[model samples]
Target chain A: MQLRFLRVIFICLMSVAGMVSAAADLEINTPAITALKNSMQQRHNQLAPYYVSGAVGLTRDGQIVLRDANAVPLPQRQAVNALVGAENQDRSALYREIARANQHPEWESEIRSTFAGRWIEKAQPGWWVQDSQGGWKKK
Target chain B: MTKKSCIALAALLLAACVTINIYFPAAAAEKAADKIIDEVWQLKDGEAAGGKGDTGSTDDRPATKPGATK
Candidate 1:
């Protein structure tokens, strides 16, 4: 009876070891995600001028994701209008710019929240950013 | 102690360790941003140095040459 008990204990220990090993081998592909996140951030910075002039609009998979007009000057309203008009006509150029900036494949969903988080972190006083839930907040 | 009680105790201990939450580090995020931005700056520099030819390809003519008569 003692021998049988020892065998069962040994089997349970071996199963537990297997579970631990499996968990250890579970590698999260975080680097790719991080690279993509960083690329989006770089794109945001590259487009900062447009954003400040209320000229930048971003969408993911045909859904308007972010519409920002935080730093637009009152005197440059015409410029803003012109840019918006161009964007409304066709934002393909803007999307292409972002995709190139990130070195990411076209048609990949741009995770706007990741970029938003980065922007919020770097925003100067009184600048505005949209949160993950699309709520506007001042930084 | 009963065998069932011993097994339950071991399970409880394992669950405690497994349930620990890893907090997100803000410093890590900042570090990541700095590194990425530095890489971007290098890319821009390379483009400036003509390592990547024709930066003008992406420029929208209307935006760049504002004084052009229509």
Candidate 2:
């Protein structure tokens, strides 16, 4: 029947909409968030060389791990840890703020996982990044 | 019901059957992730600064979505 055909078309359209919604970008900007981003950006200057030298690597769960401790000079290891610790603090807040801003704290884990992949995906060649299976490889 | 109607009914039944799905909006999650990642690492000055943010631990990764099957 014509009615049955129309129903099928309707369902198909809805399914397409559902997929589109899933792919939509998420953004959460505010004064506090702006500050967090700025601070993290500023810290990158200090962290960049360490990443290049192979002292740290990006992890699969959106965190950092000391990839090769020897890459940092013996005395500088403590400073590097302090820096990573601070950077991670801000990063965590940034993720939480994003989820909260979206009005779905439940989405935090999903957001983090997505970032986990993107961080590795966007890594520069030779920088260590964890794979989906949790193996750290040079990108 | 006619044969055609019965076939249609069977197809509808298959479509309507229930199954557990932990809806992971992978597409949406990826988009959202990329946008944030780009912004956080958005510096064009070429910095390999991808690992810095840390708010809290859900150290427990959310469960992986189970494969689709009967």
Candidate 3:
């Protein structure tokens, strides 16, 4: 009788754990996330021209890259490189901040992948985006 | 074992097996990402029309966002 009772109890406990895992909320916001979003927003205007010219592309891992240095004028190449670096820094920080805000820093990679898909999906026409196979294509 | 002791042992076993299993919320994360992307890109579909209507007016734009302190 005790063995059967224990088995039933174990199954019930497992189901409860499953339910808890299923209901996690990702939209939980904090000041850190808000700040990161605003920072990225401000940088977007400066990066827009590079994106339009295919000089910068969104990578599959949720970061931007200077895909075609030749697309930028030689004189402005250094500035574009710096802008790409800054944009990438902010992107990674945003992913980390979101995971930290959710109290599960281990979820950083998942959060990044989610953002990667969104960034590519929302990319403007003629903007370059990396595919799952790491190839760039203009979209 | 006594009935009470058996119940205690079962409870202990159950507690040991009921480990915390927090899964990543992928769908929610995607939704959250979209919201942030929309803001970062300022991708209003009607932006051009709106801009033409409110030429030289900056009221719609938020006052300067504090730049990142790199």
Candidate 4:
């Protein structure tokens, strides 16, 4: 019985260590992540106006979407679409890269969701952001 | 039917359980996300500038840097 108890304690310690190591560092970065950040940063200049105009919004899934094409001038609508597409491509890639950097590619979706919240949380006032229930509201 | 063999089997099962139950670290991810966002948004002066190492975007945002008092 004492041996069985000791086995249980040993297993508990091993599991705790496993959990700690896996969660040990989400701040891990790599060259790929830096590249993604650079691309997104450059694109933010183009996307910021739409965000303020309510033509674009931060989605609850870590993506930006053209929330209202009518809000954009007709001639600029296509450009907005292109910007949103490129931004989302980089956003998804960033999440995947971060997960891969941590050697936990399977954590991509979790990272995406976490970023989804962070984006909205860090959004400027008067910018549109999506809520958890899929509704958009000005932040 | 040795006691040593039984303990070894138990250890293996526990190890497998640990591998299978790895969790997503939400708090750490949030911190990581913020670091990336601050860099991308270039939130240096006020919330206006958005980029890295650049002076600022071309848009007519206020020139105040973030955390700067009026």
* DockQ winner: 4
* Candidate 1 local distance difference test against the native: 0.42
Candidate 4, residue B57: Cα displacement in angstroms equals 7.2
Q: Fnat for model 3?
A: 0.52
The C-alpha TM-scores of every prediction are 0.35, 0.62, 0.70, 0.73
- Residues A54-96, candidate 3: write the lDDT tens digits: 9999999999999999999999999999989988898999999
Clashing residue pairs, backbone N/CA/C < 3 A, model 1 = none
DockQ of 1: 0.07
Model 3 lDDT per residue over B8-58, tens place: 866765565444336677777887888778767877533333323324423
- DockQ of candidate 3 compared with the true complex: 0.27
Instruction: Order the candidates by lDDT, highest first.
Output: 4, 3, 2, 1
lDDT of 2 by residue, B1-70 (tens): 4556655854664453311113445676676666556656653322333445643322343455688455
Best by lDDT: 4
Docking quality class, candidate 2: incorrect
lDDT of 4 at A18: 71
lDDT of 4 by residue, B25-59 (tens): 77788888888898788775444344356664544
Instruction: Summing lDDT over every window of 10 consecutive residues in candidate 2 chain A, give the lowest-scoring window.
Output: A19-28
Q: Rate the local accuracy (lDDT) of all candidates.
A: 0.42, 0.69, 0.80, 0.83
Question: Against the correct fold, how does model 4 do in TM-score?
Answer: 0.73
Which portions of model 4 show Cα errors greater than 4 Å?
A: A1-22, B1-21, B44-70
